[model samples]
Target: MLTKAAFALLLTLTPFFALAEQAIQSQHSCFKGPFETYQGWVMRMASTLKKFDQEVFSAYFPESKFQQVQQTLDCVDFVYQVDGFNVEGYYLKPKLAVDKKLPVVMFNRGGNGRGGYVTFTRKLTFQAELAAQGFIVIGSQYRGASKHIDNNGFDEFGGADVNDVVALMDIIKQIPDVDSENIAMMGWSRGSMQSYLAVKRLPNIKTLIAVAGVSDVHQGMAERPVMEKVYKKRIPDYENNKQQELDKRSVAKWAHELPANMPILLLHGDKDERVNVAHSTRLAGILESLEHPHKLVIYPGDNHGLTKHRQEMISEVVGWLNTYLH
Candidate 1:
């Protein structure tokens, strides 16, 4: 009787397992639309998510906590190697269901140096504000902290930097609940420059927000008396290398090639010291000349970090993203 019962149980389980395998095969068919279509919808989703970042996401949904405040939130960290360098990053999700895919924001950081909270915590002080609001926030540490800088020779916003960012986006799409249609990218300082350059290669970027970005680093540095002095003390051949890399990098000169009518929001402090307000000013000029869709927010008396105006800055960014990505 016991042997007979065991045989019956095995018979009942076999069909269910076969059905599960069939379901998996059906989902993997790769024919058309979202999962089925390779370059079409997949690329489309990537473009949509390219617009969002910490500043905008927090402004839209500012509860502070991932779930209790406003939107659903989850924290995930992953490690990946870019340009032969091991790097790590995190993802922030809103308090929402996986049934309906939500928009995503790519939040990039600035500065060559690392702050204690900046690296280990992965709190995304500014980005958390956005994730609480409603968007998925993704952040990756660009290779090259002071300790690894000289030895790695990693360009803060070089090809490898862009490659890693796009790779992260690719991973985000694999999530069942992420909406491929709504996405954005935003950054400050080095990240700002990274956003400007990465968007050109990524078509899925529905919107872009670059705050105090270095549009033309070579030109920006040469024009700045302080940065120039620092550069001379560091890399004496900065000018020669800068010109050689300009065509491959510099966003200001390549603005015409960027997506037309794609919403772009730029913010900079009038009194920014480290990156200089000119970076935003010059970029705004380029956008105007190209007749692109864009908005420039110049904060009065704000410095590089905009410490006093952070909340206000966050509000403006979230508003811009909602205007476009939503």
Candidate 2:
């Protein structure tokens, strides 16, 4: 259940709290002061996504379309704690009847530290897109990682930070409209690893869809040497226990330990330079040998973000979630 503090923080983002910079660290929000209203977040994200689509991804997105999300979604931001460390979270859902509950999707995002943190812009656009599809969507910036909100603790890549993912579950349970029993997880890049670690703890997660995720950090370090730097920096006690540490993040090492009934859908861009496509291909082989129910899709010539196949991924994701989550 949301604490008085948590509930009060939510109040700060409401229309009534729009002008109250005192309600929060005003600079950490979407507008001139702090967090804006849902309508305002939607408008800002629509504009930002449009620019990203135009200059950054016109070629990849097509003549393209930048689907401006309808303002029917209620998107909000709040701070939660993981092991007592303040962590930022994004929550979104359709403006349905209060009694109408919806399946949940915990979207684990890619990138680490300040670079790939889950921002308010993403909550309104990407996560909002999923929420628009009749699901309640939530995600964490993970402790110690944020574009806003200072002193969020440390991100251990997949260490204690996994608690941030788990912490979201507690908050989700407190929400009246959240169908806590019906849940799905989708992770991208580094988030894929986070999802695996989280699913290990969240055995009740119905299913998962990992897009351009990392299955084996062992292979990840080998394929891209730069990842070692990330490991050394983000992963705690790496030098003292490199093998044990990497193994924990690598799903391939213990895929059999996961709930056997939980089907998984793995999507990757074959041409991804960031995280190797082999991670998925090799993991697919392991899942097959174990007779696990999993589907793997490889997008040819697509980048790490699968920029060329964004629409296709959405269709696949929606179908997968509908089939399993329902």
Highest lDDT: give the candidate number: 2
Kindly report which residue stretches of model 1 are placed more than 4 angstroms away from their true locations once superposed.
1-72, 113-117, 120-124, 145-157, 223-240
The residue-level lDDT of candidate 2 at 305 comes to 87
Error of 2 at 192 (Å): 0.8
Model 2, TM vs. native: 0.83
- lDDT of candidate 1? 0.63
Could you give candidate 1's per-residue lDDT for residues 94-185 as a string of tens digits? 54564566788888777542421143223435766787767888776665543532333343345555666666666566544677678898
lDDT of 2 by residue, 1-326 (tens): 44668557856644223322322222122232323444343455466664543334335332212233434666666676567566777667776575556899999988888778766555655776787889988888887776456668987899999988987777777655778899998899999988988988889999988999899999998989988998999999999999999999999999998889999999999999999899899999999999999999999999898989988988899999999976
TM-score of each: 0.69, 0.83
Best of the candidates, TM-score: 2
Worst 10 residues of 2 by lDDT: 19-28
Which ten residues in a row are the worst by lDDT in model 1? 21-30
How many backbone overlaps does candidate 2 show?
A: 1
Q: In model 2, which regions exceed 4 Å deviation?
A: 1-70, 98-100, 147-150
lDDT of 1 at 183: 83
